[model samples]
Target: MILIRGKWRTASVGFLCTLLLLVFLATPVWSLVSRSGDQIIIGANEVIADDLYVAGRTITINGTVNGDLVAVGRLITINGTVQGDLLAAAQAVVVNGTINDDLRVVSQVTQLGSNARVGDDAVAAGMSFESLAESTVAGDLAFTGWQALLAGNVGRNVTGSMAALELRSNVGGNVNVITGAEGDAPEAYPPFFPQPPVPIPQLRAGLTVADSVQISGNLTYRSPGVATISQQAQIAGGVLREELPEDETAAPAPVTTIAQQLQYFIALVLVGWLLFKFVPNWIQSLAAIASSKPLPSLGWGIVTFLAVGIIAIAIAFVTFVLTALSAITLPVLIFPVLGLGTLANLTLIFGFLLFVMFVPQIVVSLLGGRWLIHKLQPSTSSNRFVSLAIGLLIFVLLTAIPVLGGLLHLITIFLGLGALWIWIRNNRDRAPTEPQLAAV
Candidate 1:
């Protein structure tokens, strides 16, 4: 087993190296520097000469950014101007400033206040979107959300996928909406009326648009049912409402019950069993590190994780310049830069993947298995498969807890990543040295 594991590890490393070399030869790199910390804020008086990338718990940008702005946080508020594009992801986002170029955002809730203006396209995805009356977009506006309320003006086009929509403003161009089926008109009218008011259209399982809206260009909508065009509504062009295809209608979401949880536990056990079979020593080492020096391991893990990202960004930026130069003049020089950039990028990305996905699984399994063994018998020597199964079951159950579960999940990820890093460093230190050739 030891020999087999060594051979596999060697082969995997070689394959990774070869793969990175190939990527370096084929792909082009771009320049970027990523900055991350907790509660990062750029004051109004501050200015960024080049592109700015930031990740934090709360990000507030009240300064002028000469280049593009990229940010991720729990809460993000941009009150200053961006000379270039802006990309943001957060739990809640409020943009009250101007974006010289495009604006892209993903969040639970997004608001574009009256002071907000986009020089180019505005694209957003969130649970809810609110566009204040004073807000304006110079180019196209596209959004996907559960509810979209646009009380502002769009210069080019307005496109959205929503469950509920309210447009109390003007769309300079076309209006395209995919939503539920609901209308204001009743089924019948009283005899006092000249004629029965048209019954508002209703969809089987679809989307609806409110009756009060003003659009300059054509109106296009697709839903299971059609929309009722209010005579009061002003559409400069024509209206096109298409029935949603039967096959294209969304299906109901599946419910996760106790049975589902049990299945998840079983799946995790199988994966853990495989890990134990192939890399038992590595798993044992990580478990030991996590149990003994948790704090130091966590500190090192955080450092490694952040340092790798910063290094990768630097490498990629340099590689881009070198590659561009090679593309323009000396093509031969591109290879070295490409190879180095590929290695850096892959390391950063793969490390993130481990922290988020693999490390948690491995660490949780190891801890659980060890605990289960201790419980069943005072002996640490027990059936590995049975211990793993018990541990995974307990882990799954704990994860189902409401608030505590989330906190536990985070702790597990941190511990797992830390332990994994320590184990890797230890292995590197213990690697066998190659003998030097005798002097000629």
Candidate 2:
């Protein structure tokens, strides 16, 4: 029983490694993920046998992906066929290919070329979504964006929440829209028949259906303003519009202001005080190591940053592929796998955020505190608040600077991270070695 317990414990430790890899591959790869001029391109004649996952500044796929294609970059263009799902996030997404399955995208601008065909649902959110007249979607078109211009044929429903909509298409199913508040009422023109145009209120969001539109199913919409439908617009099932209440619809929050900065200062001071009270020694040690080995610390910081990122990508690729396989061959194990995958994703997100937000601040402040104490050569009777306050103030000021302040912020991050990494590594090396067993 004792031997069996030991084996199980060892297995658990091994399982933890898998979790780390999965976490690494998760979303936090955004840090050190993309590099300018490092574009990944699939040539026009090439073909990929398996799944392709890529991250860079610009990515273009002109060949064929036999499996799913997942990409994150500044510019993404797919001009070939993806035999499986297409998942992409970028500044610009242009699809001129055929997607055998679902097409999902998040970007500043998304364009589905006239020749593009999506076998399944086409989901996208961006500043603008344009489906040209020649495009054909075999499934629903669901979108949330600033503007949606549809001139294509949708096999099923067309649904979107947008600021502006231009529909010149045929929908086989329902048409649902939530328009924004930036549309003007149609202008009055003198008609020879002598019927004056009635006055109407300005719409925050406007919906326009051209004469070319044909909806076989019910047309539903929720908007603060009314839609403008051309006389020739055909709707077999009629239209249903629910007016959105002013109170129920919320606007975006304002940008950061001085009040928010002051609040942040107060919160930082309180948090620093708590950290000081409980972990003074650890903080001091990190600062001391950082100050003494500045270059080494910075180097280690870069290394650690990259190592975590690479590990994460590997994990994500492995997890996705394995999950797909398990869903097919070992359905019974899917739940446990999904649970682990979720945990891995959370770990990556939280860990990245922790380092990005807290570690740098703590390390830099601690260094500033140490520097202040040394410069003043204060007596034993001196208050610790003076040093803490000075450190926090310096950091805050540096962060406030325009362009140069951004550089300082980055430096401070490296200094702190490098110092922490060095300290941890040294301590681990200094730990006592396990005792060797002697034969009985």
Candidate 3:
């Protein structure tokens, strides 16, 4: 009995120490360094285990990390393997390795290496993507650029918006491409889906590989412009081609979900980078402060996301209702007004979508900032970092309390929204208006 008791005591102590270490790491010190007043640099060679990152500088990963990577920085480059999701922001990003989960990166130029392998989706938001065919990603591939060269393997679909899009690899899913036409803009799609994104339009000059493509699933193209596919592609699924009367044969584009994820990440990076650009010193300070209250900030962030998501969904439902009214209730004689109302509802829905989409970016930036201040300033009432660490420990242990986790989860989203609200309100126009002169 004594022996068992001794073992239990030792284990508890060990666990406590480990917990302490994690909390310590949560600070701005050894783990992630970002401050509102100082510049920090993270040049990691590699990580042996799963990792989560949050920073405010040029974060360059040249080593292996076996965990999720979440970073907000001026620049981030991952030249190593990540066993989980790779989330980052910067002016440029180059990923060359194996990512077990999803890869969400936003930068001006995102390059995937030939040896890169992703278990799930690979989303990239960039102006240009040089995707090596040698890269093996066992999931979907998505992009939002007019310039993408796919020379790799995609397990799922491919979606993109580009001027010059190329594909030279095996894909496991369908492909959805939309871009400006090459010649007179590719042909328009026959009315099939709910509604087309745009009317027939011309390509502004770009190369595309829509021909000779093999798709395992159905293809969906939404472009008003021309896309000239390369002759070396083989689409397994029946090609659902789109064309305008005056356009050339449409070239294919990239996939979807993965690309959407990438866009999400890219937007994060851009918004963060933009913040830093306008206030480098302030950003550095924010990072420094943020580390002091990571748990609190993180908790809040969760709340904001939930709130926004719910609100957005509600807006979408309302829009859908209006659309239904216009489509069904409105008489054919009053089609124009119905159409007008539908458009208005859609516009409102879109605005809400944008709000939900960018909400995280705004919240995180402020969280990062506040955390930075807490760490650097350390409130007199308590060492914010220490208090935060204790609070986190309490929160974790309270899981046995029942319903705590659920409550915490809900509370987190609200906090996030609060921070985001602050961020947006802070950036509200203070500039001299030409004049609040004439109403349109």
Candidate 4:
């Protein structure tokens, strides 16, 4: 029993440690640092020399970051400087300081304050993007969202796809926009008609160029109606309009056929056979642990499953950051990045297939088979092969039953996974120092 417990603990610990090691190895810990919390603030006097990664509910960067800054939060405000590129995602983003490189942001509302400056391109995607007067983007400005109010200056082009674009700015190069067409105005209700308590602001679609705007190059736009260009606005090149394409309809989800089910069943059977043939003892031990303490097993399984998902996400996010770094700085790092990504992907896929898709079902079926066999034929109850077969057959059949099957399958997976997790945790440190001299 001690030996069995030790093996279970070893297995769980080994699997978790392997995933942690992979993540630790993949990250560029020497060059980057990270922080997360409910509210994160980088004080004005503080400075981070390495690339910074941060996530929180509210994030404020008043200090200087000598390297790239990547942030995600509910409200993000950068009041100091970023010596390198700035990549941010939040509900609202306000940049009032300087970014020596590109600024990439995704948010509900993105604002470049009057003192804001970007040494390179400024790319933003959100519901509304506003570049206040006096702010400047040294390179091109790109935006994709519902409304864009450009009152600042652009060193190069201004390109965007939006519902409403109001430009009261200066562009050194071309201005290209894809904006919405004018929709029918709301019908006027009778004077005595009751109106809604709160008034909803409506957006007037299409581009609106103010008299103060200046474009050194051509103006190209795609919209159903002509753009509103002020006569006082300066444009060195001619204006061109392109036709807008119609929206594509989404396709319906594909239904799983009977053949797919048969194939899946066969695959599970083969996998079970392999496990039964090589790790029969391990299987029986896990079943025993699960049967003895069902609740604990279920709880552990839920935690493990969630942990695995979080690990996979972390791996993917790290891969993306590494790929970006390789592209920006060290091109040679691409080889290692690719290899790491591939390995991580394979590991995650295998883990999902084994733990989520197969292990739970197998464990539950085995337990069920043992229980049913003991009740029906006590003499043959110890026959592992016969027990597994009976359990798996019944499990598969019940899991094939329409609505109830899905719920039952889900419950079985949770229970099985929990049992495995419990066994590992309970026995990992209980391994015997030497071979047993006698059997129980």
Candidate 5:
């Protein structure tokens, strides 16, 4: 009995060491580490893969990158391509890129070109976006600045969280704004209308414009400031912002920002060294299951998603091919197939999201037994199906709304990917015991 007890105790220590190593190794690879760029003056034809994180004086981006960017400078210029998220904390941030993610900036002034294309959301927290007709933001547009003059298209929703927010673009989605201290009849900002630009003070945010400020939606400003109507900022949705004081000073520098607080966020480790103390076997079993059936669930999700996307693309391609094949003969079926395919794509998206939300839990529960799910929440895992059901129910509830739901899903994807990666290392310390192997 003493020998058996000693063997089990040794196994427990090894298991804990393995878990600690896993948590440590996984932390660094997945983390979005901040790395400062060396050059100050970025040229026009350069493309970058990693995110440009800078805390220097003046930085200009005239290149393309596949990651997010965070820069703090006096004059920031972006005239190339950024395929991911962008967060600029500076006096000025200029854009002429094909941005594929969200953009958030805290600057005195912001500018966009007529040819700019932002694939996701755009939020300017400091000054304004005053441009001519060449820039494009493909998602929701939110600005909290002294004065905003937008003259392009925001593909989705729009919001103005500022002293004075103005929009003059076509919206592909709804617009929402939370205004500060407007007049007596605090009307909600207008939506889907073309409101002519009004005259306000030349609130210098020190930015440029690409499109004419075509105010399609209603423009809501505070009751007392004189607005300047340089050009018609036509918008397809409403614009709402705070009522600016007639007398304005330089907006105080971003006092508390995300960049400043990220260190504490990334460094504060939650997984202690003793992660395998209570559920050592669960970890061992998870490792085993992960190593074997690791890719099936993840691959299934990705393949399903991509297959659906490809089908949609094929349908569009077929439509064009038919149109080219015979403009007269193909007209009969092109529109019908195109419409049906588009609808099917939409339905598939919702279905895919639902599947991704719950499939991993179900897969793990089935393969690892009630033991694994029970490890995370023992009290509720009496029935394995019940555990899966409850988890899916919560996911469904959270994913029904747009903003909150989308965020929840994105975080879930990250966690799932992390877990799958961890599963790959399951057998590192699990060499067979002599007694167990002999019995097998």
Candidate 6:
């Protein structure tokens, strides 16, 4: 019996070690070519059989990728072929190649060169997007951006929300657009648009349909002003102009004023300063834990938020039932039941408010500050106050932006809450021993 037990123990230990090894080395079992550098180029003669993942300042693919191609960089250019989906995020993305599957890109400027062809749908979002005359999309085209110039061939529908739109394309299906208000168009073309790395045509800030356009289906647009449609433009299903909804037609509320922003910034700084002063070590540890495993922290953060909300609702329902039962059958138990219910509900409310008001901003700011400091001055010892100040300022400025600010705020909330949960869980796991505090 002893001999058999020893053999089993050995096998279990070996298996555990193998599992740990695989976990630590996170490379996928499938074929993948992942690389990051200042610049990444796949030469014309090169062909990758596996999925390609690349991150760099500049990424140019002149060869072929049989599997999906995912790229992140400042500038991305695809001059070859991607047999699978092409997903890219960059400052500028210019595609002059062929994508056998879908093409999804988010960038400051997304341009489909004259020769560019997408076998499937094309979805894009950014400051500006243009599909040159000879470009072709075998499926639908969807875009959301400041400006869009489509002169391509779309097999299906063309749909988007844009400040300005110019369609000189041949659409096999419908064309639908929601454009900017009538008087919102600037006096000059590209008035607010940033200069792209690659040159693109200047477009006026309203919908324009040129004579070259041919639509097999209806041309429907919703705008405060009428669209500019050339007399010769062909629309098989005719044109329809939809009225703006009442809510949309109404004037928008003013964004936060300068005074309001200043007050918010001051309040945040004060709160952050007090927290750092009282619990420096705790703050540092939380930041460190979150930074150590960012992706996991984000995932856990989302899960925790959902769980907390669900649990809160359940508690509320149970409390209501218990209180009603006590009131009807046992008057004496009513006080106790009501008291407990009120206490639990109050605790949950306060905790949620605290997290929403401060935790996310503080955590995200601290992390950002730490990164910036480390990058700028690697040799200097990190000071929590300094980091918090720097990060808070940056956060305030960024969050002040319209659309982008809202997104950043949401992300920070999740990431911050996730870090806090992770730190608390870690402390609980080490309840028997003194928790080790790591410096930020």
C-alpha local distance difference test of each model: 0.64, 0.65, 0.51, 0.69, 0.48, 0.74
Which candidate, 3 or 5, has the higher TM-score? 3
Query: In order, how many clashes per candidate?
Result: 7, 7, 85, 6, 45, 0
Model 5 per-residue lDDT tens digits across residues 1-440 = 00111232234334333322232122223433233333475566665657555545567677676677756566677777777777666656777666787676655567777777788777664434565466788766766545666667776655554444444566565544433332222122223223222222243232221245444455443323434434444544444444444344223223333233333222211111122345334433443443344345345435545666797778667656765555566567766766676677677677656544443333332223333233334344344334333333333432332233344444344334434344434346564421110000
Model 5: how far residue 264 lies from native, Å: 17
lDDT of 6 by residue, 1-440 (tens): 00111232234334323322222222335466776779899999999999887878999999999998878788999999999988777879999999998887767789999999999888776667999999999987877666789998999888777767889999998887777555444333334455568876667766899999999999988877788899999999999998665345322222223456778778888888887789777666666655665666777878888988897888889888998998889989988887888789889879987876876787667776665455335467677777878777767755654433555676666667777778778778975322333354
* Worst 10 contiguous positions by lDDT, candidate 5: 266-275
Worst 10 residues of 1 by lDDT: 195-204
Task: Give model 1's TM-score versus the native structure.
Answer: 0.48
- lDDT computed for candidate 3: 0.51
Model 1, span 165-270: residue lDDT tens: 6676778888877765554322221233222111211222233334556788988877666665566778899888877653443321113334577787776776
lDDT minimum window of 10 residues, candidate 3:
431-440
The per-residue C-alpha lDDT of model 1 at residue 186 equals 23
Error of 3 at 129 (Å): 2.0
In lDDT terms, which candidate is top?
6
Name the regions of candidate 1 deviating beyond 4 angstroms.
1-34, 183-212, 245-247, 250-440
List runs of model 4 lying over 4 Å from the truth: 1-25, 183-203, 245-440
Whose TM-score is greatest here? 6
Which 10-residue window in model 4 sums to the lowest lDDT?
248-257
Query: Could you tell me how far off, in angstroms, the CA of residue 107 lies in candidate 4 after the best superposition?
Result: 1.0
Better of 2 and 3 by lDDT: 2
Taking the tens digit of each residue's C-alpha lDDT, what string does model 4 give over 1-440?
A: 00111232233334323322222123223466678779999999999999887878888999999998878777889999999988786778889999998887766678899999999888776567888899999987877656788999999888767767788999998887777664432122123333322222334567788999999999888776777889999989978887664341111111232355567677777878888778766666666666666667667878877877788888888888998899899999987997898798788769776776886777667666665444334344365666666677656644543333555666666667776776666577675322211111
Instruction: Between candidates 2 and 6, name the one with more favorable TM-score.
Output: 6
List TM-scores for all candidates, in order: 0.48, 0.49, 0.47, 0.49, 0.39, 0.63
